[model samples]
Target: MLTVYNLKMPHAVYGGENAMDNITAILKNHQAKRVALFTDGGILASGLFTLPEAAVKAAEAEYYVLSDIPPEPSYTAVQQIVDQFKENGADMIIAVGGGSVLDAAKLASVLVTDEYGVKELLDTPGRAKKCVPTILIPTTAGTGAEVTPNAIVAVPEKELKIGIVNENMIADYVILDARMVKNLPRPIAAATGVDALAHAIECYTSKKANPFSDTFALEALDLILNHILPACDDPEAMEAKNRMQIAAFYAGIAITASGTTAVHALSYPLGGKYHIAHGVSNAILLAPVMRFNAPVCEDRLAKAYDRCCHEAENRCQSDSEKAEWVIGKIEEIVRHLNIPTSLKEFGVPKEDLDGLVEAGMLVQRLLVNNMREVTPEDARNLYLEIL
Candidate 1:
């Protein structure tokens, strides 16, 4: 049944506490002299970048620090960073933050060498020309921006989020340091962990999925589903943080290979219109979408459920039972972590349901990946069910 499948990823370097120990050698390998360090203000404020900053300084590479990336990356914001990188003449880029910062750096790194600007790059695919070598160090356990070849950018005027899908956008190196996420806030740990879980689940159930992606997604799902609660309970637990980071990276590979489905497609409008956090939006839509997809994807759901349960045969009598059990487990986790379960609770007015449906319809790229077809009507009903 498998025709073709490919899994893409950066050269990942994983370690605990000593993850940055090899940064110096990596820079030397790339022969990067002038470097641009990209991150957000909050990460810089938290001092997580202190070690990397010191490493760049110690290497005596001419470096410029830009901490102005927004919570959600925008086209205009990416252009500003590109300008800085061009001005500094940086031969290399190092991104250290969550998804937004890493994505912004990815777009800017490739755009800096190309004749095309942000608008042209977003509008045209395969126009990306490889530019400066870049390294991504994630401070959070979610988003998996470290290993993925995709970057999401928001266009405020259009109220739409667009992804730059190009292999050239993938980072040259991904550093997974347990120390960086040791002090992560509880809410972020919960939200990002859920985000990784959604990525794993959606990719596994996507229509394009094949053996390669299934292996990665299931492994990632098992890791996240098992450790998310403990990770949320103890922020400083190194084992939980480490596993979450690896799980997110594995999910990133899965999503890249198979793509995400209706859940991500439906969550986009909330992020675009309400500025709701992406993970929170996904968390709200996860269960309802799974419920809707059950008829077609029950076997897939059951397989995932079995991985979560120690005694699957005794607990789940049928595919329907397994699907419901999986949905119930997700709901339980969301509740325990205090994630709002309804669109209304997330501050979407009842009247705006139609608008949300319209927005969801626009994300055909992700919708087509759903195992079960999701029409505009299906999107509306799913939102209404959540409401």
Candidate 2:
């Protein structure tokens, strides 16, 4: 029997052009002072810093930016900021970049009152009661870090991706100013948009799917289906990027409630082992995972598959026909976006498949959420099939 579940997001999420202008009001409502701004260097140099920098001044607080974030940030990197925030005495944090930067800030807050090292969040595999308030400002359309309760962090010694990095790491606020995404590379735009699409699809089809989350997921899917290509085609079009960015955030909220299933569970190993980047990993694994789950979800996915496919491909009227059409559409998008199609492309040997399988099995949080019960053997077969 299906059940009803409540869905929630950050306090407020603002989208569209000049959206950052509302930051002062958001901070005023929260009475944020002594802020520590967290972001990557690229965004630090991207002129976006100006808005937040000015907002901190207008709000009359001592906000300093820590911009040394990497493409794949580790817990050790986040500790550096935590120590600084401790000494600097920040009451609130302003996270202003892609998912990585926002995640770093979220994790840093967890370490604020930690008796042990910052690594506890990654190593413990559970929830934390102590964390500081962070206002998340997403500069990209993918990752949806702002609304997501979980943060994906890589741990070097463990050689694994931490999906259950911290359950309570959810942000206090999320500002989705589309202006920040205007400068993203077209390829980055396409890849992240696909990540958002995967988030919606997998959550909607998962074992934990519920009525409320399904509403957000399906609506998010519809927006991405129509607007992602436009955002990629013309990055400066704030309208298109705005819709996709909003869709990504809503998808994040949707998945937080229902959880992402097979596609996400399978995508993790690729990113953890190969360092393929999360979105690219999802793009590589989505088609194969969808095909694998087709037997269970075909009845539900048929309509989505049709909508995702273009007119040229959807002429075939049957559901199975539409499934094939959907695969073709995805391949076209991946090909145009210039992401590799297989693990071999990332130099994962036939030998490395098992290692990837073992790593994935360790992420029980996401693996258990699969629409069907999955064993290590099942995961191995899926990796081998893709390999």
The lowest-lDDT stretch of 10 consecutive residues in candidate 2 is: 305-314
Most TM-score-accurate candidate: 1
Model 1 segments more than 4 A misplaced: 311-314
Each candidate structure's TM-score, on Cα atoms with residue i matched to residue i, is: 0.96, 0.92
Q: Please name the candidate that would achieve the greatest lDDT relative to the true structure.
A: 1
Which regions of candidate 2 are displaced past 4 Å?
1-4, 123-127, 165-167, 306-316
Clashes of 1: 0
Candidate 2, 164: how far from true, in Å? 3.0
| lDDT, candidate 2, 260-379, per-residue tens | 876777777676667888888888888787777777777667767655545673287777776666666667777767777777777778887777777777777777767667788888
lDDT of 1 at 3: 69
Cα deviation in Å at residue 2, candidate 1?
5.0
